[model samples]
Target: MRTSRDAPTRRIRAAVVGTGAIAAGSHLPALAALAAEGGLEVVAAVDVDTGAVQRFCADGGVPHGYTDLGRMLAEQRPDLVCICTPPTLHREQTVAALRAGAWVWCEKPPVPSLADFDAVEAEEGQEDDGGPYASIVFQHRFGSGARHVRRLIADGALGRPLVAHCQTTWYRDAAYYAVPWRGRWDTEGGGPAMGHGIHQTDLLLDLLGPWSEVRAMAGRLVHDVQTEDVSTALVRFGGGALATVVNSVLSPDEVSRIRIDCERATVELTHLYGHGNDNWRITPAPGVPAGEAAAWRDFGPDVPSSHLAQLRELVASMRAGQRPRSSGADGRTSLELVTALYKSAFTDTTVRAGDIGPGDPFYTALHGGAPGWAPAPATYEEASA
Candidate 1:
């Protein structure tokens, strides 16, 4: 059920925080397209870079540009706040937006850690009370291909998922890490696992449902940064499925892929950043009706996953005062998996779902001391020794 203070469908005012590449490249265009359709107005944008924010607003034709988020919220009182900032700033920015009575659509790696995620979650209004909730931008899940696959998996059309593989293998060099926040525990959160591969794995979990346990390994194989550049894990899903996951920033050939072998059929999606219907393939097991396999391949239309795809659904959820997909528990689930992956990697233990809590070192910090790299984590070898 959804509850809202206003009519079921009304024009909403929106503000964009962080006028960086993501804001200029992805979010602004989506907002503009939606604005033209009379869904919302892009009233303001916020960023610490004065010149950049001004140029962004001028180029995007947003009415107001402010460096201070508090100022923007006070001035615009937007119904929706689209946060395109770094992981570190997400918690504070989202909490502020929710307190100002706005729904949030934040960029991925939503907060630095689970504790930060929980802090932002605390400030959100109840869905039954016409909330101002914060939703992580997991745009990958919004694509038509994923939606179609999820429907098939849920309906048992694909039969029980027995085996799966999820991998996010990409390359990032020294220049990319030179940004200061790109490869650090305190700022960017983690390596490709939290930063790059999260989208693909989140989509994996979206299809496979709950994961029961994970045993993982991560190392700083190439990067000189505080976090690992590559990691691998074996996961057990609640329904008795086993999977392997790899997150790496050292691969020469780049790809984002997920393949699931179910009891009756096999499904695969291969794409780099975003995917369309053509990227997906389904093969029914032998003896299954050929017509059934054809029906499984029928994805209605091609909606490539994008910031726009998620923003559209988020806006509708805000207007209807409903708990949108990828918010609250749904949003937190992927973060938990990442955290568990890290915990399992660092501690050499098989971490289970619901294992990390207030007292758990991993609950508040991925590196297990505090949110940042404070006490300094022992090397995996040192821990083993």
Candidate 2:
């Protein structure tokens, strides 16, 4: 429902929760940039650790900081709230903010499980008009490369996408796993599949379609952690398209790539050093007509940082009385894919998407919390220290 004329003239008042690495590294900077551009104004910050929140405010010159989220919401009444907490805390905090009448932009892996997502969804429907509408942070979808690929597919330039392969091979050492929630089944969700490879998985889902079935295997091959460090899955899309995914935190070097083979051509992209698509390759089928080759055009620099672009969109949607591009329902789809993967891994069989829903036992177990899965206490002390 948002119109172009609704572009925010003054800063849209905003607040942020969780002052950890992600908040400092991405959300804060992105919001600050938007504030400079007259898109958003960060009014307050909240975190369980009072010292951390105070320090962050001091460094960023923020006006207010609070240890309690409810108090901050009551006092600030921000139009926007950024949930930068871990995957486990996303559902509860996001729902709280939504109930408090603040629009929410939560980081990726919006919920640890599908049941949690359902809880949030149910609450979303019950909230008043002034309450927040939630959106998950899947920034890669905002990238030019992703958009270009989507355009090609939508325009039938790539023909019918038949098979897709996604790979996210990265390294996470003991030092990385030293954090309390880095490699846990409970607090951090699964492992590399949920934590590291989720970005690429989201991109795959964005380009292709929703998954219908998944067969997967997972193991903790490298890290001294409870969750799997490496995982792979065979996914079947709704339109009979087949796909494969490889996610790992133990590769010698990091290589993030996706290849989609369509009926007419093959599209590929690689983001080696970071999340940016630095290299792209498109190849047409052999003996294809010249006109088809001409249709394949390379796009120019149009990539915006996902966090910044999504935040801009969120603000725009709020001003226009419209919903965000990635809503809670959209987030639930991705989480369902993840849940299918986990179920497939545990049972050593293919798991259908329909088999896991709000009332299913698997769904119940996921939200009920995984018992005997706590990381060593030293990890907490190290993270807090």
- Leading candidate by TM-score: 1
- The per-model lDDT (C-alpha) reads 0.89, 0.79
Candidates in order, TM-scores: namely 0.95, 0.89
Model 1 spans > 4 angstroms off: 1-4, 370-385
Question: For candidate 1, lDDT tens digit of each residue in 1-385?
Answer: 1224576667788899999999999999999999999977899999999999999999999989999999888878888899999988898889888998888889998887898988899998975697878899999999799999999999999899999999999998989999978887788888899999999989999999999999999888887888889999999999999999999999999999999999999999999999999999998899999898889999997999999999888887876778899999999999999999999888889999999989888888788753333346679999999
Q: For residue 216, give model 1's deviation from the true position in Å.
A: 0.1
Q: Taking the tens digit of each residue's C-alpha lDDT, what string does model 2 give over 1-385?
A: 1122244465687898999989998899989998898767889999999899999999887899999999998898887789999888998898888777677888887787777777877766322242347888888777676777788888888799999999999987899989888777678887878878888888889889778999988876777888888889999998789999999988988898889999989988788533443566788998878776765756667664368867777777777666677786666777778778877787777898778876565684442232333343467768899
lDDT of 1 at 158: 86
- lDDT measured at residue 266 in model 2 versus the true structure, 0 to 100: 91
Listing every candidate in turn, what is its Cα RMSD in Å to the true structure after a full C-alpha superposition?
A: 4.3, 4.3
Task: Report clash pairs, candidate 1.
Answer: none
In model 2, the runs with Cα more than 4 Å from the true position are: 1-10, 125-131, 272-277, 289-295, 366-385
